[model samples]
Target chain A: MDKVENVRLVEMGQSNFIKPYRILFKQNKKDRIWDGIKVHDSVSVLIYNVTRKKIIVVKQFRPVVYVCNTTNNVQEGISIDTNKNPGTKGITYELCAGIIDKDKSDAEIVKDEILEECGYDVPIENIEKITKFKSSVGIAGCTQTLFYAEVTDDMKKTEGGGREEEGELIDVYEIPADECLKFAMDESYDKPVGMIFGLHWFHMYKLK
Target chain B: MDKVENVRLVEMGQSNFIKPYRILFKQNKKDRIWDGIKVHDSVSVLIYNVTRKKIIVVKQFRPVVYVCNTTNNVQEGISIDTNKNPGTKGITYELCAGIIDKDKSDAEIVKDEILEECGYDVPIENIEKITKFKSSVGIAGCTQTLFYAEVTDDMKKTEGGGREEEGELIDVYEIPADECLKFAMDESYDKPVGMIFGLHWFHMYKLK
Candidate 1:
């Protein structure tokens, strides 16, 4: 689903996600400033299909990845052409996740995300909390709570892709549990830290 | 060492870290845009002291964390008082990490960081490579290459507390291997995802 074209990047004018700030603090009488952005805290899930013994994952195009890979130092006055920098660089294998913008509990949000993104109806009681950690503390120190759940083949109901109305085009895929660590380490596939950590956690605690 | 004072947060001005941008693209002939920031790619080390059978970590005061914990919504023209919002929320136990600004190999840079931030002298050969991952994909997607190294008490050449010239004040400590997962899971200790993943990796592959 990465049929991306007509890519253009520019200096940010209006942003829906970034709220940049500078914190000035004095430690041991020395003044220091740290620059960061305020972002939404989110939740992610690592889903395992028990009948097939596979890790269900979602693949989609990420704009930040595309922009960073295509731009060199983000030099001003220079425009990027998609031909020179292919859009394939932006595609990544990610865990089913959603930003915490709803009033529902974190578990409910993730359960709903699983159904919307991967076409699975996971029971709310079956969802297990793994842990939550501060993500990317250097720039944006936001929290991301991770969860785990086991699903069977019967649980699948629809042809899994992200919500089309939201302009999302996600592809559903799976990886064998035994090969997850290897896949996580592979440089060919771009991935996030949460996915890698979840894969390792699964091999350590699950798939016995 | 979270003795912070005179904490004030304001709208970002000439940030040395954040460079915000907006990207516009067409996927399947549908127009879309994404907001993100360009930040420094970094390096982190998960150091395990073979002689002590413990994981070496660094605790420091993060300005971003402190400001986020204190400020409500980053409202403009409003000043923050540190007394009302304690600075302790800014303190975190993290892996020995440094921004990849220096013109050296990632391994050499991480080795130097171990000495400056954690007071250890790990050789280049002992520094093993872990998988690199994209961090905080939604906002500032930057590459963070992780490494692992084992050291002995002899490597403790100095009292590790970061470089004073750079205005860094870090405390060095260790955690027992058997209890590391529990410590990483503890909500009382503010930490980064890289540190948690590193701890899990150490238990899965490093510890005998």
Candidate 2:
């Protein structure tokens, strides 16, 4: 264990959109103090095609990756001219998910996320709450609930790539049930934990 | 899909200790500007006791819950006098984990987390990188690498519940291999996604 040291707390006002808090605490029997942040909880939905044995996912450009992957050659500060560089680090494959920042039941929020992100009209009753988990405990203490639902092709109401008004550029992709593990767990694939968890749950509890 | 409206970006300065960036993006082919934050990546480790057929986990208070659970009854603002309140909303059961903020390899960071968070002196070679995943997509685009390691009782060099010097109050708990799913997915249990992924992997590949 690292040697414990001084600890202090600095309070910052919350943002209208994002909530960022600076927390200071100690460790190793109160010998060291450490600082961290806490963010909002979220929801991840796994939509399965029962009739076809397939799972639906989405691919998008994450601004966080775009900012983190910035090179020294690229001058800091917002350079809207990123098209000149054509960066690809921001592209990611993830489960249909959203932050839990509304005044509705978890199931209701996930239902909306599914409709908005994946373009599926899944009835609220069809969605099953699998489990709730922290997105990351060490940094942000935000929790995420995992959900699963089986849908048929008939449930496809509109071309689902998220609402156009939010500036979301989503490409929906479906992989066969048997091939989900190989694709989701592929080391080269930019798969998130929620997607992997959703795949595992389908194979263990739904498929068999 | 909720109608996405005019979107815009408001660049915010980065912090020294914490990297909090304000990101604005569009959705659904619209020009609606939104605001969000970007955080650092992290790692989660699942330690298995091969001889005992049990999995190791840790419990701690979450600052997010401490802040979210506060209401009219609980006084707000940096009241460092929480010793009188003894709050309990942040307590959660999760896999041994840590943030990837250092200049070490993912394997090295996880190995260090195992030793510091769980008291297991595991060899780096014994740790297997299962996969990498995003902690949250809509909010924090931070990614986390999931690693699995099997340790024998002899590897426990010290009592691990997090370093006391950092003001960490952790309780170590172990669930039998056969009963992990029941406990981890028990809706009532405050289980995290990494633990569920670990148990499912153990059942799918290790056990059978």
Q: Which candidate should be chosen as best, given DockQ against the real structure?
A: 1
Stretches of model 1 off by over 4 angstroms after superposition = B70-72, B77-81
Cα lDDT of model 2 by residue, B1-208, tens digit: 1111111112223444444445443322323332334456788888888879888888776554444333212222353334433434556778888877799999999988888888889989989988887665555566688888999899988778777555566777788988877776775555667777887887777763
For model 1, what is the error of residue B149's alpha carbon versus the real structure, in angstroms, after optimal superposition?
Answer: 1.1
Clash count of each predicted structure: 0, 36
Q: In the order shown, what is each candidate's alpha-carbon RMSD? A: 2.0, 9.6
| Model 2, runs deviating above 4 Å | A1-15, A22-41, A69-87, A100-103, A138-140, B1-17, B23-38, B69-86
> What local lDDT does model 1 show for residue A183?
89
Model 1, first chain, TM-score of 0.92
- TM-score of model 1 relative to the true fold? 0.94
Residues B18-90, model 1: lDDT tens digits: 8887877888788988888877788899999989899999988777666556655765555667676666778
Estimate, for each residue in A88-176, the C-alpha lDDT of model 1 and write its tens digit. 88888999998898889999999999999999998998799999888777787777899998988999987679888887888998999
* CA displacement after TM-score superposition, residue A185 of candidate 2 (Å): 0.2
Measured by TM-score, the strongest candidate is 1
lDDT of 1 at B80: 64
Error of 1 at B208 (Å): 2.1
